[model samples]
Target: MIGRIMKIVSRQYTLLGENGEKHDAILMGKVRRQDVPAAGDLAEAEYVNGRWVIQKILPRRNRLIRPSCANIDQALIVMSVKDPDFSPALVDRISMLIMKADITPVLIITKCDLGIPDETEEMIREYENGPMKVIRTAKDEASDEVAAILEGKISVLTGQSGAGKSTLLNTLEPSFHLATQEISKALGRGKHTTRHNELHSVAGGLVADTPGFSSLDFSHVSASELGSCVPDFIPYLGKCRFNDCIHQNEPGCAVKEAVESGSVPQRRYRNYLGVLEIIQNRKEKYL
Candidate 1:
């Protein structure tokens, strides 16, 4: 039987069969040594001696490194306007990873009632018109647009700790009642709230509320490939005078030109540079 892994806990997997039937299965020892199954993974399982064991994980369309999950249709890059504060660098980093994996990235800004800073507001306007779509909503007001987008799709929530990933889900569906925590004032960040990645049924779609990311892994991406991953840089990509342009300090770079002409938001461009540096540093460290 092929079933979707709803959740894994204590080395036991709760799988939802293709026909909506549920099964409690264990991973085959050989498969576990080779590869482990993720929350959203569809695996080949079998009932032998009255025990279901997952034999293998099917090929994944995409996978996220942090809060690891597989085969995502879209990722909700949730960020807050206040409290933990809106983070463009973090948002850009997450979006790039999602885009590189060939998954659609949607920006969901929460905590609007806290008020958007002038800089944050500018960033919002750019992202709204930028490559990915942005959905603005308060911590209290759930978005119908988001609800509509969720239907029949597999979506995952990724953002900072206090950005209200679980809170947004709770607002969308009162019954989820997912755990949420307050931002730590002394540390000036959100405390870890979500422990494990679990899929929930909402709006006829499966949504996974994975642990929020304070740090990201850029190991799967390369420096030269980074520019192409930025959605804002796509149109001006191949138009650069030099075919090898990474859009940073390169002569006759169309992307940098677009940044100067305001075709791309300056803030987003800066964030891109910041991530590019990070990726380059990581590569250098390894070499």
Candidate 2:
């Protein structure tokens, strides 16, 4: 029989069977010898001698390395307007990672009640005009739009530590009772409350709450492949003067021209250059 893994605690895996029954299963020796199944994995399981054993893990559609979740349909890139301050670069990086995994990226802006900076608001506007869907929510008000977007999609919620990812999750499902902590005034960040990635049924879909971090590294991404990760640059990619243009100081680069003409957000372009530099440096170090 095949079942979806709901939770993985140590050696035990809680699987949701096809018949709506929950089964506590253990990995078979052969399966254990290979790769271990993540929480969102679908596996072949058997019930023998009153014990359920997972024999094999099926193929995954997409996987996130940081949160360690598999088969995600979309990524909710949460960002705060004030507290830790919004970072467009972080959003760009995470969105790129999500796109690389072939998952849709959705930008969720939190803390709107605190008032968003003019520059940040402008940035949000630019992202809305881009590829991904953007949603803004506040602590005082419920976001029906956000709830509607989550419906029927397998989403992974992730962002900076103090960005209120857990708080937003609780607001979406009041009965969730997910533990949330106050932002440390001295550190300008919230305490890490989500220790592991676990999927919960919410808004007619499975949502995974993941550990938060302030920064992300693109060590796995190569400089040559970095341009494709930026969704906004797709339109002007082939229009560049050079067929193999990386869009950095290259003459007649359509992307650079777009930035100059204000067609592309300057902030996003700057962040793209910054990320490209990092990827290039990593590539050089390996060589």
Candidate 3:
């Protein structure tokens, strides 16, 4: 029988079978020695004796390392405009990672009731014109627009610790009852409330609320692959003067020209450079 893994707690996997039955399956020795199945993975299971066992994990369309989920269609990147303050660099970095994994990225701007900064609003507009879809929401207000986005899609919801990801999830579906923590005023960050990733049925789709991170490190990505991750640079990828242009300090670079001519958001370009530097530094250290 084939089933989708709904949740993985410790070594036990709760799989939703094709017949709508739920099975508590353990990994077979062969699967254990090869690859472990994550939440959202479709696996072949068999009833051995009186217990069900996962025999094989099918191929995944995409996977997220931080969340440890598989076959995600898109990512709902929840960000706060106030409270924790908006971090465009963080959003860009996450979006880059999602795109690199061949998944769509959606920006969810929360806390609009608290009033968004002019600069942040402008940045939102820039992203709207770019590749990803952007949505704005506030506390206690339910958004059908958000529901539409999640419908029939496997989405990974993630963001900074204090960015209201849990609150937004509750607002979207009160039944989730996901734990949430208050932002420490002294430290200006919220405690990690989500420790594991679990897939939940929501709005005709499966959504995984993953643990929040204060910062993201792109150690897995190489310096040469960095430019391909940024969506804004896609149009001018091979148009640069040098075929191997990394878009920084390179003469006749189309991406740099776009930033200078006000086509690409300067802030996005700046963050790209910042991430590129990190990747380059990591490469140098390893060498």
| Cα lDDT for residue 247, candidate 3 | 92
Identify the superior model by TM-score, candidate 1 or candidate 3. 3
Question: lDDT per residue, candidate 3, 62-129, as tens digits?
Answer: 77667888998988889898888888888989888877778888999999999978988887888888
Local accuracy of candidate 2 as per-residue lDDT tens digits, 103-147: 888899999999888988888899988877889899956689888
Which residue runs does candidate 3 get wrong by more than 4 Å?
182-190, 212-215
Clashing pairs in 1: none
What C-alpha lDDT does candidate 3 achieve relative to the native structure?
0.83
Tens-place lDDT per residue, model 1, 84-150, is 8887888888888878878888999999998788988987888888878899988578789989999
128 Cα displacement, candidate 3 (Å):
2.1
Residue-level lDDT for 231 in candidate 1: 87
Q: Flag clash pairs in model 3.
A: none
Better of 2 and 3 by lDDT: 3
